[model samples]
Target: MALKFHIVNRIREQVKAQGDKTALRFQTAKGWGDISWRQFGQRIDDISRAMLVSGLAVQDKIAIFANNCPEWTITDMAALQIRCVPVPIYPTNTPDQTAYILKDAGARVLFVGDQTHADIAMSIAEQCPALEHIISFNENVDFAGHPMGMSWEAFMALGNDNVEQELQTRIADAAMDDLTTLIYTSGTTGEPKGVMLDYANFAAQLESHDKVLSISENEVSLAFLPLSHVFERCWTLFVLHNGATNCYLSNTNAVREALQEVQPTVMCAVPRFYEKIYSAVHEKVATANPVKKGMFHAAVTIGNKMATSIQQGKKPSALLQASYRMADKLVLSKLRQLLGGQIKMMPCGGAKLEPTIGRFFHAIGINVKLGYGMTETTATVSCWDSATFDADSIGLAMPGAQVKIGKNNEILVRGPMVMRGYFNKPKETAETFTEDGYLKTGDAGHIDAAGNLFITDRIKELMKTSGGKYIAPQVIEGKLGKDHFIEQIAVVADARHFVSALVVPCFETLEGWAKELNIKYHDRMDLIKHSDVVEMFEKRITELQKELAKFEQVKKFTLLPSEFSMTNGELTPTLKLRRKVILERYKKQIEAMYKKHM
Candidate 1:
């Protein structure tokens, strides 16, 4: 496939060929509404022209502080079309975090998505002196007395006074090497660093992804993950690249409702999304009558057999084929309906998904393509092939990307998808790569002879026990997390006697268990502390740790009342545990687990 060097050029081509086709769809009070390719192109032109009229020049930094919405993409493409660099800040970030990013990037213009985002921008406007213009996508934002503030409509009006010729000139100046975006990593440790990615970086991602997965114009993709992150950003661009319609969900709380409403063909999500679905399916099955439960299990057995044959490139037995068709009608079809009944592919990234969960989704006919990548690599390095995939491994390195195990079993990647460098941090950027130029992924894992990547744990997160054993926390966590009663867990083993964990229970299921056992409690905190409840989790944890090595098992644990959330500084926006934050917050609880023996 011939790839366009500049992203806007691709959009322009799509506009010419598919002018009336839906390019973007968004929810409204009445119903879902769409913007055609021609309209999308026109909006980009208007936004680009507005940037030029506002005294912004080539390479000027512009920040987008917003959630996932149509306007976010419009602003991003518009800025890139004018040869200006776009800096995206997570909408969940507080004023301090948001200000730090804006000030560091030296953003000249800031676009706010709604009143909440507008307030954060305005609160920090004085801190970021370079931010001279504030444009709100929400018309209701009242910046009446503020000289620097204007609504998106008023901003577009300024574009009407300028000719489209100037915007075209800027687009023509765009180059593959030009800085396209500054994606700030939501660091699991330390301060967030800006990973500077050029046009070629994303271009390489587009090309490498095509080698493993094929998308067409007929595909409909749902955008629920934050686009500020590289994964969603790249995936959305690829959807647009193939002339597919991209649907935007205004609120993540409405994802299940939106999934059925839009019936998207493709989706990019984190492991939490899949885990929830898996949990819900199993929960429903567990409550069914004996015959229904038996039927469900029988259907899964047939589906698994069919999946294994298909993956290994062999035809299933005639009897098995007939059984699978019956299984689909009797059991599997209902499960597929939860995802809108049209999902063909779902690319899961950002965290480790239990192999069991991955296999369950695949057996049920949802191709959950689990992959691995970081912000430094433009969000994708490897993913399982649908035809021959292993649930235990992140599939072969993407085409044109080199992957090798480095010192300490670290996974290193060298490819066009690797980022240019961190913005304004030469020393840190230099340390991020090896002398041979492969970007140090900082993840400890090994590649199998068959070329599959299996990540064990973060190098920095490896725990050393007092007995001189090195424990991989993520390995233990992934195994323990499969139990329906457990929601989140962080293992603590560094310089300790044995492994212990801080676990957050799956409250809904725990409550159901409590009700069945007649365990009394007033609230989540009270429930977690009940002796019966604690004893039940203890038995469950002990049972789940059976597959682990003796040294790697979580011997003792503390059940917490709440899940680790981004707001609480326990998890990153992508839902990966912030190990350092978690350890520091629960130091006393972790220390107590080791004290009984002492």
Candidate 2:
């Protein structure tokens, strides 16, 4: 009920209910530490006062250019409480991208993660004319006498002389129509566009999310995904609304270590996280002794049957149920340990998750709820219910949201969670919706009789071959990228005679395989082109292609020495492939494949 108001209301409610309860936990060099709910609310109040002291006015834009840490959420809540619009920029963006967002949002104050972020902000200060103040979250950072920059310690001290009455008045004046945040899209194809969200959008999300997911006050959540993105940001708000403890991972590289330490009951992640976990599990099992490997496979087989039965709301056969218990003891339990042995529900979105991987995890009792949405929809459009889960689809539409398959099968959505419009892009915003009120999702999908939403591909990403057959590259890539040796893949089929691919192999595994076979190689480039290595991949691709139509199967593939990355303009901030960038970068390799066939 508290969620009906601004998200700050929920934080205050939690403080009143559990003043001394641990609300946030983060890993330190020595171990883990926590901050209580009362302390969290006090920080928000202090920060909100500081923001006002630093010249932040109601409806003013403030940017938080930081990673997933406690400060990011604190600053976001501070903005919400004071009715200021918080604009978040990805921590990985370059100076140019950073400046563009600041200038576009007309951000008056920028909160940086560290000295590096402050340096970037300083570098673009001239370009971002409206940016007035720079505050560093890390107190220990050396400012070197930057004119506009101040340490967080100095910034927070500015509020010490202030009373709480001013911040309280601002919170009391909070309205649903006030602009809450300006979330910029990752701009996989072009410059990022700011999506405007309001209090009503968030309230709708909380209502819809409540109908599908039930989180207890005792549950804990692991927060690793970038807080700038809507998927993580909105989910974090939900966690705070439910009064659950959230553990933050300072370094994403330490995800495996943190997972074991946190052992959270609920988590939100993208498909990539699950894919990596699946790959790691298989890579380890592949090296196990034959008896151990057999046991692992047997466990999966039994677990899959049990999972399937449970998903369909039927009891597993007595024999299968008995086998699952044994499997859980021998193999599944060990697998669960990698995720901290206590994950009850994990909601995955951002990209397509292969159903096979979904089955693999669910077979072992991990409920991986695959869902679908975009930044424009305030994150949640459709997600699975635990009792009526479907691996192949994103499940039924969330409550208060209406979904329909429109012209060309593009997923159309109409709901309160939909954004008001793109900031300062009237033409673009007008184009994004249909004559009817529904927002055009740009994703091609179909809903089955059971109301399960199965995504086919991005409408703009669909490619037509020279022979005039259309193909969904994502589906093909999803199928092939799940291979143990394939780390990443982008299928090339646009105007080409046959489908091809650019692959980045899992170099560590590939090297191990090479050493076992006595295949000598100097580097990745050499290993990728070796005849034996090519043949091994060819055999694997041939087997995988059996599931696809002839035109949809990749006819030729060239392995690259490097992986696609956000820094390299090949991937977006959310790790989604930038198809146009990838195609342009590998044009020569793609052209050669067609030339040889001709």
TM-score of 2: 0.98
Measured over all alpha carbons after superposition, the RMSD of each candidate to the real structure, in angstroms, is: 1.4, 1.3
Worst ten-residue run, lDDT, model 1?
Answer: 1-10
Model 2: residues with Cα > 4 Å off, grouped in runs: 1-5, 161-163
lDDT of each: 0.89, 0.89
Candidate 2 residue lDDT tens string, 1-598: 2445467777788888988888999878789999999999988888898887776788999999987788889889998898999999999998989998999999999999977888899889989888888999888777688888898778888885464677888988888888999999986788899999999899889777877898877889999899999999998899988899988886899988898888999999998888888888898899899999999999999988887788788978889878889999998998999899999999999988988898898988898888899999999899877777678888889988899999999999998999999999999999999898899999999999988898999999999998999999989988988888989999998888899999899998899999999999888899998999999999998997788998899988998999999888899999989999998988898888878999
What value of lDDT does candidate 2 attain over all alpha carbons? 0.89
TM-score, per-candidate, Cα-based: 0.98, 0.98
Each candidate's clash count: 0, 0
